[model samples]
Target: MKDFLPVLKILLRFVIVYIVLVLLYQFYLNEYENDVVDPFTRWVAQQVAFLQSIFGFPTVLVDSLKLHSILFQTEGRFTTRMVEGCNVISVVILFSAFVFAFYKGAKTFLYVLAGLVILHILNVLRIVMLNIIFIKYPQYERVGHDYIFPAIVYGGVVVLWLIWIQFFALKKTDKS
Candidate 1:
């Protein structure tokens, strides 16, 4: 029984943190009108559009609230849309939960903060790349959206967790 206690504690922490963050996010979504895009998603879409525009695409961002997503248009032609899933909030919540579960010290919060920012920026780049793919090679949209981008985002989270465990969570070895 004693051996299982630590594992159980970590599990509980993970579950509790995950559930609380998800509930908070759901509440945030509920506070917004269904016809309007939620603020976080809107912010992510804006970042994606800005980056695309920087690439000379002249991207147009449209908050098609009725559709529950932000639309991207280039030169009056619709390119793609960014749904709530593209916002990376869910991933952020998950990453945070994991970090909180295996929390090491005061520095853990800083790691979490840095992870969130890194994931946010990576997601923006992913969306911008997806938009370009959708515009240029519509046929590969499925492969890119469903497989490639998800790998990039989730794989990044895994790497961050591994790094945290290796450096922050683990006590350093004696080096004489």
Candidate 2:
């Protein structure tokens, strides 16, 4: 029990930081709903528009999902909402905190930071792909959005965690 004190302290710090960050995020989301959400949504929508333009997919912007404008192009409809579902910031922060708590030294820190950046890029690409999928096959949107994209995001996190454990944590244990 005495030997585990350091580990427990690190974990507790991680949890506190995580909670604080999450609360701040929530507060920001609530306080600046339109200012934050709209810009983000617009940016994502614009990116989708650009991608669709390149790919020659038909695209349209409706007031909601109800109205119709055109077809094929990616929709930016849900980009500016309450930041629920597929928000990458939370995941990135959590993964970063986890790595920082468990790992030691600059090399491990750099690797974890790099991994986090890559994960976020992949997540953005995932969003783009999901938008395309939603546009191309409207029927599959539910499955793609709810399940498939989440698996990709969370799975990436899990893989990163495993790598950290295997390379840094477990290796150190084995050496000592």
Candidate 3:
């Protein structure tokens, strides 16, 4: 029982935080009625479209009814859709839960804030990259979107977690 205490604490904290954040997310979703683009999703689509335009690709983001997404279309054809999940809130929740559970000091807040910003930028870039890839090679859509791209985003979260543990969490744990 004593040996399991540390693991138990981390698990409990993670579960509690996850539940709370998910509940809040549910409330947010409820505020936007059916067949509507929530602000976050719309923002992500806008960011992707902006990037595409910057890269010399004419893009338009439109609220999609049938798919419940902010679809990004290039060359007057649908390229990809920025749905709720593409906003990366779920990944941020997981990252936050882990870091908060093992937080050491004031730096914990800063680390989480910086991590979220980086994660958001990475997510936007990921979408843009996927859009270009899929448009150029339509056959690779499944492999890129489902496998390669997700690995990059989640892999970034893992890297941030490792950095936190090494620089902050582990040092504090050793001192205590």
Candidate 4:
């Protein structure tokens, strides 16, 4: 019983944070009129188009509130609609929950903030890359979007967690 107490505490923290975030997200989604998620989706689409422009791909970002995503059209050829999933909010919540669960100190908060920013940037890059790849090789769209891109972003989060544990979390444990 004693041995499981620490694990239970960590799980309780994680669950509480996760539940709160999920509820907040749900509330945001339920705001159908003058929805907040649309603007975020638009921002992501705009950012993605900007990234595509840097590579000289001639991109267009179409804002469609009804569609609930930003339509990314490149050279009037290939189009990739970036929805809420592409925004990285869910991943942010998951990462935050885990960090809160194993939180050590102010350092941990800083790490979580940095990680969220990095993850958001990576997600944007992933969308841009996927659109480019889809335009160039339409056949590989499913594999790139479904597997390769997620592997990279999620794999990055896993690496960040490992670094936190090794450099920060463990030090606190050792000291205590």
Give the higher-TM-score candidate: 1 or 3.
Answer: 1
lDDT scores of the candidates, listed in order:
0.88, 0.64, 0.88, 0.83
Better of 1 and 4 by lDDT: 1
Q: Mind giving the per-residue lDDT tens digits that candidate 3 earns over 1-176?
A: 99999889888887888889888988998888685578887888888899999998889977777888887889879888888888999999899889988856688889999999999999999999999987898999999999999998999999999998888877754436
Clashing pairs in 1: none
Error of 2 at 93 (Å): 2.0
lDDT of 4 by residue, 1-176 (tens): 99999999999999999999999987876775455245566677788899899998889876667876667878886478877878888988898898889878798789999998898899889988898888888899999989999987898789888887788766655446
Considering TM-score, where higher is better, how would the candidates rank from best to worst? 1, 3, 4, 2
lDDT of 1 by residue, 52-102 (tens): 889978888877867888789976888889888788999999999999998
lDDT of 2 by residue, 85-171 (tens): 344777877887787777577866787778867776677667667776765677888888889988888899989889888887557
Candidate 1, position 162, lDDT:
94
* lDDT of model 2, residue 22: 81
The C-alpha TM-scores of every prediction are 0.94, 0.71, 0.93, 0.91
Which regions of candidate 2 fall more than 4 Å away from where they truly are?
A: 23-31, 36-48, 58-85, 173-175
Q: Which one is best on TM-score?
A: 1
**How accurate locally is residue 49 in candidate 1, as Cα lDDT from 0 to 100?**
83
**Which is better, 2 or 3, measured by TM-score?**
3
Candidate 2: clashing residue pairs, number? 4
Off by over 4 Å in 3: 172-176
